[model samples]
Target: MFNLRTRDQIRRVETGKSTSNTTNGNGSTSQFGFSSMDGERQPLLGHQATTTLHAEPGFWRHLLFSAKSSPGTNSPNPFVRWPAQVWNVTKITLFSSWINLLLVFVPLGIVAGELKWGAPWVFTLNFFAIIPLAAVLSFATEEIAGRLGETLGGLVNATFGNAVELIVSIVALRAGEIEVVQSSMIGSILSNLLLVLGMCFFLGGIYNMRGQDGHGHEQSFSTATAQTTCSLMTLASASMILPAALYGVLSQAEEDNKQASILVLSRGTSIILLFLYCLYLYFALRTHQKLFEPEVSQVSDSDTGEEEHEPLLGPWAAALVLVVTTLVISVCADHMVDSIDALVATGKISKTFIGLILIPIVGNAAEHVTACVVAIKDKMDLAMGVAIGSSIQIALLVTPALVMLGWAIGQPMTLHFETFETVAFALSVLVVTYTVQDGKSNYLEGAMLLGLYIIIALAFWVSPTGALGKV
Candidate 1:
């Protein structure tokens, strides 16, 4: 029998997005339906959830269908339905996978660096090389997770989704690029919260605003998720606040005890943060898992209908691909880090800009795009999960893990960020919390977030290189 849960699963499968569904009970069989961005339902024929959309129609076909079948007294105006049409085009083009072709730049980067190519050239090649490798890593992870069922799949995706950024940070840490690592950490959180999420809300607002009456349907953001995200961001701000204060007080003290005290405090804080993160995962996946499930809104009395399930790559094959792609990312990151000094030495850009802007963008490009795409499709829950979830991981998992890893390798990384970075981090958390409090969003709110991010970015861009000390 088709229920709300089953109907949502069928919708995902029909659109070629893979998700695991388990039948809970039995009921009367009914026709399948596709849900539009405005929560409107269109009926289609099917029973099994594994049924695939064979030879799916192109953008024009869907647009025409949407225009003709739309229930209204007004004419079939494309402008009124621009968001839906744009999404249709996005769905078609997503399959092109042209980024895979950029993989060739990996070996080319290695060759250029070995042949004494200039810093700018090597950095450019290696930076571009990381983008495709990051995509490959993401694809391989998704393929493996698709086979693991929803609960475990969500866990895996949350844990490993930011592998590219983590890898880059680790490589930079090894090379004594503490400022670079620190800036990138804050940058990842900012980019996800502001840039990526803003785009999602902005596009979602546009789509929802184009509904029949033009006021648009209210986007159903998960209140549970939003509250939890705000709490986590608060925790992140607290974690950094103490360290930043401690760094300031100790900076004027004896150098001998200053570094030692900071290291001890950092290691202790890292341990605590890691413990907190584990608790969060347990609460999210085990204790309150139901709160995290996708909420379905029924626009009609739908009947039982099944759709074809999309298959995934074999586990072993997916694992192998993940391993190989991650290894390639590591190599490229090493070269990229090696070239950072050269690039900044030329006076064209600051280290802050490189870390806060360039590095995070390169590593997270694929995930960023995925977040926006899901938002465009009106999957606000999943979109928030991607954006907010990644930020939490960076704060609780990646930052602490890097600190511990650095200590283990004798590099002794501390959580002590500069004054400006500390302020920016705190401000970001406060602003995002305010925006998400109502569990609603619009393009204007999104623009506000983006505007704040731009201001912070410009501040960093103009700061002289090395002005911020390495703690």
Candidate 2:
């Protein structure tokens, strides 16, 4: 049904860690990790609940979340005191992304008018520039959360991390630039693997290097079943990219007549593979009840305490912004399409190369920043989730949609990606999935992932056509 709950559950299953346990009418637990507790566990009494005399048990949750959400505070900003703290963090990040988009859009609009033409370069520069802006925001967010002793980091990333790149994906779809769309897939994978993961490992390594608390060993992540599920799903997604690249670069012997066969093959394979993986994921969760249930039956009495809070923008407003941003990003691509095409040609890059590398890079910019931010806070699993999740989205969803839309547009692009690209993506998933399998990652592993990207980049740069496997 395309509900976010299913998506969230799939993701939780993938990561092997969602604590949203619900009890059924029969007195058994649901697939999620919660157990049935009696009426005594519920905190009651109307007057005390209504008043704020005592701080909740969430003091740690709030402290860690708030301290890390914003910087320059010795403790949680008493002024912005769990729920309000999370709201404060969201407002700041959303506001930054909003301003960041304007910084890119407004200047580019002016330059585009002056050039008497389109200029994706303005957006390009804007996209890249935000990496630094992102770095600052990320660092500040984590540090603030730490100081305030709150843990808003994950929520922050969800709102701005891949969400930003998701915006860019809509942008590429609108541009109708097959090259840009393909490249966006490439960009997204690279940015997640290299730029974001790399920064997290590098910075986290330095932070943990001091080692006074020996807390680097702490990982409250989740079950092996969950991580494996996510890891396998990611591999499935990355693998799906193969036929597209292979067909693109393998041969053009019957280039004109090749279109229909490619479409049928690509579409057929995508649906089959996507469904298979989804089913596999469902069974992995449903069948393995042991994996979801914690061994120690007695959960702490205070664990169910709810923190006092409200949404930053009311539910309707946040939902509206999310929808509106997608629409705007989509429309903006319309102006950039022609300009970006010319840039690729004058710069002597192939359409496949442009699509495979550049577009993904721009599209994934926001996500890259957000992943690194989470990694720095030592939430490597979530960081890897964003990276692999983005890749899966590009492969399973974006690529097929591109093929369909291209057909409707009369251009008729295929899902076939190049061989080198296909192999590289597979390896990227391997590296991340394996490295993160045990719920641990270090700078050396981060370096290994980044090195893979660099090797691929150098190869692409020196290649005759600026992509892989071209004759």
Q: Using lDDT, give the best candidate's number.
A: 1
lDDT of 2: 0.47
C-alpha root-mean-square deviation, candidate 1: 12.0
- How far in Å is the alpha carbon of 338 misplaced in model 1? 0.6
lDDT string, candidate 1, 23-137, tens digits: 2112222222222112232111101221222234342343343211211111145443434333322332233245767877899998877786899999999988888788777
lDDT of 1 at 440: 83
- Local distance difference test, per candidate? 0.71, 0.47
Candidate 2 clash total? 40
How many pairs in model 1 have backbone atoms within 3 A of each other, for residues 3 or more apart or on separate chains, i.e. clashes?
11
Instruction: Provide the global lDDT of candidate 1 against the true structure.
Output: 0.71
Candidate 2 minimal-lDDT segment of 10 residues: 42-51
**Clash count, one per candidate:** 11, 40
